[model samples]
Target: MTTARLDPDIVARLVGDAVTAPSMHNAQPWKFVFRRADDVMEVHGDAERAMTRADPHHRALHLGCAAALFNLRVSAARHGLRARVHLLPDDSQPWLLATAAIGGVPGEDQELAALHTALRRRHTSRFPFSDEPVPDALLDGLRSAARWEGCRLTVAGDWHLDTLLGLVRDAEHREDIDPLVRAETAAWVSPAHATSGERRDGMPAEVFGPRSSAGSSAVRDFGRDRSMADRGWAVFEERPQLALLGTPTDTRADWLRAGQALERVLLQATADGLATSMTSQPLEWPELRWTARDPLDAMGHVQMVLRLGYGPQGPGTPRRPVADVLEIRD
Candidate 1:
């Protein structure tokens, strides 16, 4: 079958939607190159944006880029197009994460089209969530979404939830003692007192959420080294509804699959009127990362630890413009 020619304007617009995906510290670590000759948009991981101390192996970087690729699919479907994606198409060049070759108009995938509506709506929620339980049907839908991408979505239950929470706390302690990790986090998180040339990419002071006075750590501690006078305190839910995204393997392709699945779950949760937060805390530490896996489940490798609840949506973070991130090569 011959591939349909893609419109240049459409390529630009689809990439615009893709960059809205969330990344660690809002690093926005992705670059897209559209090859008009063969009709493919290549996604590349920008090593410059990689967090050296926090994510040395670039796993988080791959996840962020793949999430953007997922958004690209949503954008394509919304605009009546289809994207045929191939992960790590070139082994010689490891930085090239995937390539979504533009194809004919999108066919009848109503579910994918539906997620397009949530692409912009989904944001990380750092505020406190109410103790109310999420409906079983909604959680099941999210589980199915992850399963579609060859990953497992396991919801932590009872004692398992406590273990996950303790793991987060342990990760925080590790971050505290490691000066290099603290410095990396501090570099990305802006301080309230910093003079004018502040960055738009990292975690800003306004959305740091409140510091936990009761001693339970949030997924990530944006407030660890900074003191913002305007920030206020609130009580987090006693038991946070947490879920884990895992895959059978830890290959780069697996990371790519897990990343797409992670974004799908988040978007679905957003559409269902739920707020979400993610912590790679345990995943960041090789030793602690394995313990995050549930013994009852056959989840081979945990990719991300997610917190889902009903709470205030996180403030919208910044992104590099489509023009800056996407390039068209005729």
Candidate 2:
């Protein structure tokens, strides 16, 4: 019944909204294939764009792609449609993350639809935030957003925060020593793309924000040693308001759920007028990951470390043209 309505223009627009999702280094490591006959869109993770050293197991990649998946759901709901998803739908094709069968189940997902306004507004802010703490009430709403997506969002206390900060430093030290990791990260931070704006994807120099004069405890310093003119330094907040987004188990499926939950939390934060940034620096290392988790906390495994506060919104990163990542089949 809805097949006739799922035209190329509508599908293209939906995919365009989906690509606005944030990915690691803004790599935009995802692809969407729309099957007109079935009215389903296939989400695939692009191996060539994957951060080989940073995301060895592709866990972060899955989270990034899943974030895009969540945006697709939001777009569908906004258009009075529903996306029935099946994760890892094919055992034969590992990169084929999931497929969303679009059906016009209008009014069923008003909450997801409501997040549509925040889709473009949500950007990963890398600048310093004010010392003003986020309210407990607003934090609670963000927690609910994660819970609705079947994940846990834990606010880091003093001790936990210290541990997390240390881990970030440790990860930074490791990245400094590991040449592979540094090269991989540098590949995505494109200077030419920053000024020329020719490349469709990658984090440009301007979006790298300023250097953290506080020795980069709370945030990942992507500007490390890069002699980019006018990239000044700034002092970050004394105590960052950190949140841990976790899942019951660490698997491809769990990573997918984590991605959806991550975006939901981010979108909710944006809607609530909060500036946000996230770092997987600590979680990227297996040795540092387990230690980063609070032993007493019930969160089985941490999927992401997020910094939330009031601050200057980070400039938007580049994204692949919809034509570059989307394919339509008869």
lDDT, each prediction: 0.86, 0.90
- Candidate 2: list runs displaced more than 4 Å: 1-4, 192-195
| Residue-level lDDT tens digits of model 1 in 142-213 | 999998888889899999988888888898889889999888878778765223445657877666778666
Tell how far residue 75 is off in model 1, in angstroms: 0.4
Model 1 worst lDDT run, 10 consecutive residues: 191-200
Q: On a 0 to 100 scale, what is the lDDT of residue 143 in model 2?
A: 96
* TM-score to native of every candidate shown: 0.95, 0.97
Model 2 per-residue lDDT tens digits across residues 67-88: 9999999999999899998999
**Highest TM-score among the candidates is held by which one?**
2
For model 1, name the residue pairs that clash.
none
